[model samples]
Target: MSAAIKRYGLGILAIAVTFIVFVVPLLFMALIAMKDRREANRLEFSWPTNFSLVENFQEVLSARKFMLVTAFINSTILTVVSVAILVILAAMVAWVLQRRRSRWNPTINFLILSGLIIPPAVIPTIWVLQGLGLFKTLTGLIFIEVAFGLSFCVLLFRAFISSIPKELDEAAVIDGCGPIRLFFRVVFPLLKSVIVTVIVVQSVSIFNTFQNPLYFLPGDSNATVQLTLFNFQSQFTTAYNLLFMNILLITIPPLFMYLFFNRQIVAGMTAGAVKG
Candidate 1:
């Protein structure tokens, strides 16, 4: 009876904490977004007497001739392209690094680890992009995101690969399957869970990324979803209602993704853990 009560009590405490920490702020933001300009500007947690959610939504969409729409498209393209490359490339590299033992493996492993530890130098990266004639282009930004995300994805892939049976590789090779086909057909299908994990994680991060886009892919034409926030912000004045509305809109996608795929994320994260 005492243990049961303690368990119930702990659960209740966790629920209360979650409500206070996450739900409160989300509710507050929604309330503000639904409010009119004057009420939202107050930044109070109180309910608004005038709810103008539709009006604010329309205004935000039409702002700067639908820059938000453009930003959304750009962000989608960026996320899709970057994550696709990261998954395929990372998975292949991880497979090779796991299956093949070579003298150069240590050096290559060091570089991958270094990528996770070292901060990317923006100026040098920009210089290289410019030299390659990819600066200020979507292609350049795509490469930047892929490069930054590669190490983490590779590490996850390598860890998971270690647990896979080596017999699968040997059988595929004996059946006269090439390396590319073996990976694509045999291993890639098995990576669905981790792939979902990587895609969702990287997609959210890339979509929410502001600094890299701002620094590397500058200009209104190349604006991303995050940069759309600047539309409601300025030196002297800020459109609080519209800003909150924008925030509400931009935050919805990633929130829904996590809600739906949270299980897969946990499973993938714990995939290579010790069983004993």
Candidate 2:
């Protein structure tokens, strides 16, 4: 009884804290988004009298000649292509690193893991991309996203892959299956949970990212959803209503994705923690 009380108490406290920290700010943003520009500019925490949500939504989407729509299309393309490549590459690399035993394993692991710690050398990357003729292009940004997101996804995949049995590998090999066939046919299907987790988590990360698109793909036609926030913000005059509405817009897809895949995320993250 006492333990139950303590657990429930802690859970309730966490809920309250989360509500205060996240929900309050989100509610404020929604309120401002629903207000007219004049009331929204006041930035008060009061209920709005004149709701202009539809107006602001339309204006935000229509701003700069439907740039938000274009940004959405660009962001979707970036997220989908980059994440697909990332999943396949990361999975293959993690499978090899986990399954194979080599003297160079530690060195390889260190090199790959270093990507997580290293700050991107933007100017050098740009120079290299320029030499390769990929600068200021979606292709360049896609590569950047893949490189930056690789280490974490590899770690997740490696952890989950470890939980898979070696017996399956041996059985597949004995049955005349090659390495690629073994992975794609037998082992890959078992990775559904972790794959879903990686897809959801990395999708959110890539979709919400700002600086990569801002620096690499500066062309307005290639703008990402995050870059559309600049439409409402400027040097002097800021459209607060439209700004919050834009925030409301960009925040929805990821929020829905996370909520939908919440269970898969937890299960995948904990796949290898307990070994029988």
Candidate 3:
């Protein structure tokens, strides 16, 4: 009875901490987002006397000829393409790396893992992009996103792949299916849960990423949803209310995605915990 009580207490404490840390800040931000400039300038979490939520959203959406819409489209394209390519490539590579036994496998595995630890070299990357004539292009940004996210995706897929039975592969091979058909038709289908988790998580990440887009894919036309935050901010005076409103709008998609796919995320993460 005492141990159960202690566990309940710890759970309650964790919930309280999460509420204080995440929920409180979000509520404050939402409150500020509904305030007018005067109340926003005060930066208080108190209830607003004058609501300006619609006005703020309108201003943010209409700013600079509706650049936020453009940013949203750009972010969507980057995320979809990047995550799609990353998922396919990462899954294939992970399967090969995990299934194929060779001395060089360790070296290749080390290099893939190293990507997670290594910081990107901005100048060198810029030079390469320029050489490839992809600088300041959406294609360039997609490649950057895919490359940066590859290592982590590979790790997840490999872990999940380990949980799969080797007999499935053997069975498919014996049935006269080529390796390509075996994986796509046989192995890939079973990876649905993890793949959904990866898509949801990485799509959110790629959509929200700012620094890579800023560096590798500059210009107003190529801006992402995160860069749209700058529309409400400036050097002289920031429109705090509009900025907060913009933040709220941009945050909704990913937040809803997580809420919807959270169970899948948890299941996929634990899929390979016990290796067969």
Candidate 4:
């Protein structure tokens, strides 16, 4: 009984600490978003004297003439397309690498691993894109995001695929199944759990990505949600209330996604760690 009590106490303490560390900051940000410009400058912990969520949201929405909405749409498109491509390509490549053991497999693995270590050369990438007439385009940014995110996704998929028995593939092949059909019909369905995990994790990261879009696809016309934060900053001053509101707006979607998919993400991430 004493040991159980001690464990319960520790668990409660840990929960309290987590709430203080993570939840408190989110609550504070929400509070600031609810405050007026002057109250936000004051940055008090107390409840707002006057709730201005609608007002601040209107200002943020109206800023740059509804450019935030456009930016959100751009981010949604980039994140969805890039993550979908990453998952499909990574799963296929990892499946091939893991199932087919050959002399070249090690070399290919090494190259994929190199992506994790190598820092992308921004200028060279830009120059290459310009040479190909893809610079300053959404497609260019989408491709870049995919390339940047592929290594980690591949690693995850490869690890997950490794745990799946090779006999499944062999059996399918013996049944006269081609590689493409076998993968889609037999193997891909089994990967649903890990794929959901990758989708959730990558979607959130890509949606919040700031630097790639800023450098590769700058300007209001092609701005992403993260880049839209710049609209709140100016040469002379910054609108803290509106900025916080925008931050809050940008934060909610990813937060909701994680909350909704938390179980799938955890399961997928841990599935390989324990088995593979």
Candidate 5:
């Protein structure tokens, strides 16, 4: 075969491999969600024998109406507030770090980078929050989400800000603009693309987080969506049909967000690499 034909053949093979590795498992989950408990347990690839999507969903939703509703509300509030704070705070800090040169800048950068490398001390965090009387509250969970997500968001924003022209800041300063005014008016507007990217990525991650909520905010009263998975599982056995339905419900919002914002994520990630 010609070189061009061989290259095209290899590309097709790679695509096929990727589909098998990623798409196939997602397809299986979708199929299982639509199947009966017996069929789901068998884990077959064949079409579902009995389609009871509505019934399964109703069972899961009716498990604990008040608790489920409250959990949904808590999750929404935590994810939205945390992501908003992360984007704004990280963007502002990154803008200054990129614009100003100082010995302290490297130290601050290193501290932020350390968050990604170190494992959180869960018990210590709980102890501190309890002492502050912030334990088992939705607001406290929001703070935890922000703490975990801040480092990565700052890194992303800093990389993007490095590509912005410092001359813009100089001109703004020349126009008698103060630092805060300059950032809010001039720099923040230019960060719209990266903000959208951060929102899409961090919003999904914070919404689906299981560990923090389970350990830090564990209780029926303060449960988030991820913690609600336990409602379908018991010590003896799990209700497979209802569990799958709950999984399906929880998966939809993030899946739709990704599908919608996929283009923006690609553009934001590539923006710095190309421009900087």
Candidate 6:
């Protein structure tokens, strides 16, 4: 009886902790977002007497002539292009690295793993981007995101690919399938779960990313969803209510995505462990 009671108590405690940690802050932000500027600037957790939800949203949306909407489009494009490159390239690289053993395999493996450990150098990256004539462009930002996200995607792909049966590879080869055909048809198709997981995870990260976009891809025209958050602030004054509203709007997409793909992310991550 005591053990069961203790387990239940612990579960309740965890629930309370989660609520305080995540829910409380989000609720507070929502409350503030719905308030007028004067009330929001007070930074109190109290309910607003004058709810300005519609007004705040309207101003935020139309601020600087619908820049937030433009940022959303840019963010979507960047996420799609970057994740596509990361998924295809990372899966292929992981497959090659895992299936083929060679004298330099260990060295290559170390370099790939090191990408996760070593932070990207912004100045040097910018220099290279400028040299390639991709600086301050969506193409450059896409490349930056892909490079930054590649290591983790490769690791996930390698882990999941290891669980796949080698017989499939052999059979495809015997059936006169070329490398590209075998991967696209046989191997890639089987990686749906992990690929979906990667897409969701990377999409959220890239969408919320601010630093890389600010440093490598600067400009009002190139502003991402994250950069729009900064637009509500300035040296002299800040639009707290509009800022919170903007945050709430920008945050909704990723939140909904996680909610939708929660199961797939869990399944994909754990699936790799089943066979390997």
Model 4 whole-model lDDT (C-alpha atoms):
0.91
Candidate 3 vs candidate 4: the TM-score winner is 3
How does each model score on lDDT? 0.94, 0.93, 0.91, 0.91, 0.87, 0.93
- Checking candidate 1 for backbone clashes, the offending pairs are none
Instruction: For candidate 4, list the clashing residue pairs, or say none.
Output: none
Give stretches of model 5 more than 4 Å off: 274-276
lDDT for residue 261 in candidate 1, whole number 0-100: 99
Query: Please, what are the lDDT tens digits per residue for candidate 1 over residues 1-276?
Result: 999999999999999999999999899999999999988999999989998999999999989989999999999999999999999999999999999989999999999999999999999999999999999999999999999999999998888888899899999999999999999999999998899999999999998999999999999989999999999989999989999999999999999999999999998888777631
Tell me the TM-score of each prediction against the true structure. 0.95, 0.96, 0.97, 0.94, 0.93, 0.97
Q: Say which prediction, candidate 1 or candidate 4, comes out ahead on TM-score.
A: 1
Which residues of candidate 3, in runs, are more than 4 Å off? none
Candidate 6 displacement at residue 167 in angstroms: 0.7
User: What range of 10 consecutive residues in model 6 has the weakest lDDT sum?
Assistant: 267-276
Model 1 segments beyond 4 Å from truth?
A: 1-11
**Local accuracy of candidate 2 as per-residue lDDT tens digits, 131-247:** 999998899999999999999999888998898999999999999999999999998898999899889999999999999998888988989999999988889999999999999
Q: What's model 2's TM-score? A: 0.96
Worst 10 residues of 1 by lDDT: 267-276
Candidate 3: tens digits of C-alpha lDDT, residues 1-276: 999999999999999999999899899889999999988999987999999989888888989889999999998889999999998999999899878779999898899889999999999999999999999999988899999999999888999999898999999999999989998999899998889989998999998998998899888888889988888778999888989999999999999999999999998787787882
Clashing pairs in 5: none
- Clashing residue pairs in candidate 2, if any? none
TM-score ranking of the models: 3, 6, 2, 1, 4, 5
Better of 1 and 6 by TM-score: 6
Q: What TM value does model 5 have?
A: 0.93
